[model samples]
Target chain A: MTATDTAARMLDRGVTPERYARGWHCAGLADAFRDGKPHAIETFGAKLVVFQAANGEFGVLDGYCRHMGGDLTQGEVKGDELACPFHDWRWGTDGRCKQIPYARRVPLRARTQRYETVVRNGQLLFWHDPEGSPADHDLLPPELPGVGTDEYTEWFWETVPIKGSHCRELIDNVVDMAHFYYVHFAFPTSFRNVFEGTRATQFMESKGRPDKAADAGGYGDADMVLTSEATYYGPAYMINWLEVDYKGFVTEVVLINCHLPTGPDSFTLQYGITVKKPEGLDDKTAQYIAKKYAEMFGTGFLQDVHIWQNKAPVQNPLLCEEDGPVYQLRRWYEQFYVDVADIAPDMVARFEFEVDTTKANEFWHEEVAENLRRRDAASEADAPLEGAGH
Target chain B: MASFVPTSEETLADQRLYTAGWLTSVSCQDCLAVVGVQKNSAHHTSIQWSAEALAACPEMGRRPRELHAGCPRLQASIEQAVRAGQVPIGAGDGF
Candidate 1:
């Protein structure tokens, strides 16, 4: 297409609004907030304070106090309330003013915006709705299958602040079947997408390329087959059940990829991983595997970050058959952007798209062979002269 | 598997309103079992198979579930169907 045609197409697609999606956004690891101290968070273009009560209940409220606008997160946690540092005014988890140190009675209307909080899969998530609607608990991400059990290690969480991109860029990866080969270095054998209601799922079975994997920190071997079923519970949270089988040494990993918008053009991306402990393995070894797997996963995400940092937002993407259902996935994602009344039937309607990977597999196999040939040639050139070294 | 069954224009128009608008039913040339197929591009073909179709497939029935990536016979049939314009590719063409 001509530049003018491209510009016109982009104009027709329009710009993504500077708005945070309405759903449960993760704050951080739940363990970080259970220290009986209020933790300050910046998200959704607003400040929030996450605190835990003595009884282990978590509370999320506006970071500023009602009276004099004091930063509540800097204050101390007293029982089930968070005491404002500026005036020592104690506020209950319900957002009601409980006590004023010098006043005879606290004002009945003295309250701040309290967010609905849910702790699932060991992450603290707060509900956000631009329309101020109450959270539907049913819409929250379900509990991970192997988490919190003896079979899995504790969650290893990492948060990175992504700049110059909207969070939707990350969400678009759900339907991008081709990205696995080009971006993540996996040759997808079969790829499918299912979008229904508030959930969008991607099912993929892929074989790893050794050359590409080595460049991305040697995470995968050529013989490995990675099968993953990843689902987005809402706009931000995605739970991926990934199984990597390398010559029968199988590892099942639960990867949580979630993010919260910090600004119109930026977001804080957070991902947590928990590896299932193999039978007869020691706890120390299991813990080590979990940490290494998390780092390897982090490296994979960094690759995407590099692209998102420089890429422009494309609303009407020119897609191929192997591209999966990008438009359909975006339509499903629009449900979170609109009010309940404005949501279209197609947005929630069930749509399934599966890419026949027969051709892709053949093409990727050839590519991998070509890549390996180049790598071997380079390695041979770089090798020290065998007799000269002796 | 290389032979394509010519579909009428009326049937192609009717396919646009199917639940999966981009997909059209193509029968396996060997087994004669129908499976929904869509070729989004030259390199991408999507096939949706029903249980009855899978059961009727001579090749798929012999293979274990885990080993079944796709039936080669059906894949060849789908490719031929796409080449003959029996399957629609590109956005909004079928829908």
Candidate 2:
């Protein structure tokens, strides 16, 4: 190919840089920032400071002090304000200078940018708008079920910093049904996608491969079925309500998967899981089970990470019939990257797609059976020879 | 059969039954308690035991309900049944 042709091809396949999505992105677990200490978060090409007041209120402000560009996170928290490490200038949660220990008077214009933040389901989420628009608290995600109740275990959180891939790659999984089998060892029986204004949902019912299911402890029953209804509130936060039905009993699990763009091509993906205490189980056993489930679920996300780390961004993907609505999902996701006034009507229009899993199920069933047969044969081959030691 | 009735939409009656619908009951060699058993694959095994079966197994009867794992005698009996073609692997049609 000519140099011009090769350059054009690269451009066609490469993901172009775009502005960060405007929505509430989770910074981390709420408890991580409630120790009366300020934590620094790097995202959107800027640094932010997250701190909690003595009266149990959370605050997020620009990391640098407006007075002398001092790192506030490296400073101390004095009462309800964060003090700068350089000159000990105390700034309130509202980003206004409260006291300057060395100055006679605080300047009227001595202030920094403060972000709107909320704690939902044990997650700390801060609003991010590219155009500097104020956040609407009414648009926040609803409270997750069984979050603070005694019936559910505490949230188990995990974060993976992924590099060299746009956050869109993760969003594409909302419509990609075929990856469940190949990547996650799940045989999806039914799958559906719904996209509306600022929200996209994926409803899936699946059966795990016997070998993979065995690793999930009590969920190893032959008749176990997994159902998940995962919905993205806006661009970054997704809440998945999962149910694992094991013939005689059922387990309810909630998974929160959220991300924030650290750069134009890199993002930090985080996921937390909480499991309802099974009936007749001790609290210790329930906690153990929840931890195991979190590890298993984390493995599934890492599988996606492996593929994303090695693959190139595809602008025009060659998709088949059962690929779900990738184009429609991208259209819906585009609304967040652009200014509110420039958003197209189609970006917020409702679109629904239901994938027919009959063909995929047929193929997956055979593949799973073949895999099981191979495993059994290999086990027999590896078995000790009869009377070998004798 | 279990007398517990599922109340919520999350619980399905069909999913309560064993995937291997044709498997016969296998009696524990030590406890002599019969229970329905099915082996879907090398890794998945489902056992349906009743109150009477639980009471009959001395090992299970001595332990608390929460501490009860699978009875070793019953597992051995099921493994023998699989080897004898009495409980076939991958015989169910359910996913």
Candidate 3:
């Protein structure tokens, strides 16, 4: 309460303090699932609330029970109301605790929390900023295939959360295609990365919308072939879109999503993968696709979960050339936190791309395909015969 | 007699059909699925680890011991909880 202190406090008050601009965190996928509904994602930061509207369109809320810090998912879903287990209070999608069955009359102070949800592509989206409405801001994500449909089957994502601000470093981890050979060691050597009809070099700035580049016309552009796109703002969250190369079988979308400003050095990422099956495919084929993804992405995901849980949110500087265009990219992420606030996007950008339909051939070649085929045959030497009775 | 399907590596299936008929619940499902899916195959454990692989399932990779190292205390707690039926996650039902 000193005069100088009072003056500084007054200056800080009502200043908005350059906080995170909440919006789409997870891609639009987690929603009221058919047959198998969306289960809870067990991370501390977000409360996943999945609501299937009358039209089968789902709204996945951010899990902040607006009433008394309660969780929305814990509520018993009625025809219209999800009754809060704590108080038997009912809340409709409008976010109002509409009824208290046990109460004599609807209380004047009763209000159930609600979030603005939009499903773009397949990921169910909830604007997470805690301040803005989905109507006020753009609620759509960069487009991907099969995002708007509920027919596709999805693989269960292993919840591996890292503690830290998800910034340029994490996004680059997916953008840098060269790492598959060495870091992940998938291929023996690195391959060419193409962006905008030219071979990309380093990553352009990752500060703006992932599709929008800050150093678009930089002195020399970076070369990268992205199977996906990433975007981040303030300390809200970061999202990376990776298109699953399903060999043209069906529409497949993959995304890496995480929260930001995880207290200087710790952040968590929840990775969800979705795949669309072929038309007229039986339930068996759908199950096959899900199982395949669980292997392909699940192994790597488990590794990330273990390593990141034990690792730092920030880097220790032992970076390699294969590391994405991270030198400038990290600076962009830090800027969103420290330097820039109150700045909005220049203009609305629409992201739409055709899913890569190239079948696994030619580049995959004969030898590799043959090897996989043989391996598969050997493993199924004694598998069950069809209709042998389940 | 419960039916079991015989699969080969070439036409490997992603879903290992548990043809135990009525024995598909948790109690018998895991054990039966393991036996039925393997069916004298070389990669019996492969189904346990990477059951998602198609065409030819590969040998299971080296895994961290801790990942599969289930704790007795945790196991006991989970079993007790299951036996106590589904309780709310935050409920202090001696879990």
Q: Number of the top candidate by lDDT?
A: 1
DockQ (CA atoms), all models: 0.08, 0.01, 0.01
Q: How do all the candidates rank in terms of lDDT, highest first?
A: 1, 2, 3
Quote each prediction's TM-score: 0.80, 0.74, 0.46
State which candidate, 2 or 3, has the greater lDDT: 2
Q: Can you write out model 2's per-residue Cα lDDT over A2-91, one digit (the tens) per residue?
A: 333224422234334457888999998999998999999888878899999777778899999888799999999999889999999998
Chain B TM-score of candidate number 2: 0.69
Candidate 3's fnat?
Answer: 0.00
Which should have the higher DockQ, number 1 or number 3?
1
lDDT for each candidate structure: 0.77, 0.75, 0.37
TM-score ranking, high to low = 1, 2, 3
> By DockQ, who's the top model here?
1
Residues B1-95, model 2: lDDT tens digits: 11112332222312232112434688888876887665545533545555567668787666443221356777788888888888866544432
How close to the true structure is residue A130 of candidate 3, measured as C-alpha lDDT?
A: 42
In model 2, what lDDT does residue A309 have? 93
DockQ of candidate 2 compared with the true complex: 0.01
Backbone-clash count (model 1): 0
* Interface RMSD values, listed in order for every candidate: 15.0, 22.3, 27.3
- Candidate 1 ranges beyond 4 A from true positions: A1-13, A218-220, A381-390, B1-95
Q: What CAPRI grade goes to candidate 3?
A: incorrect
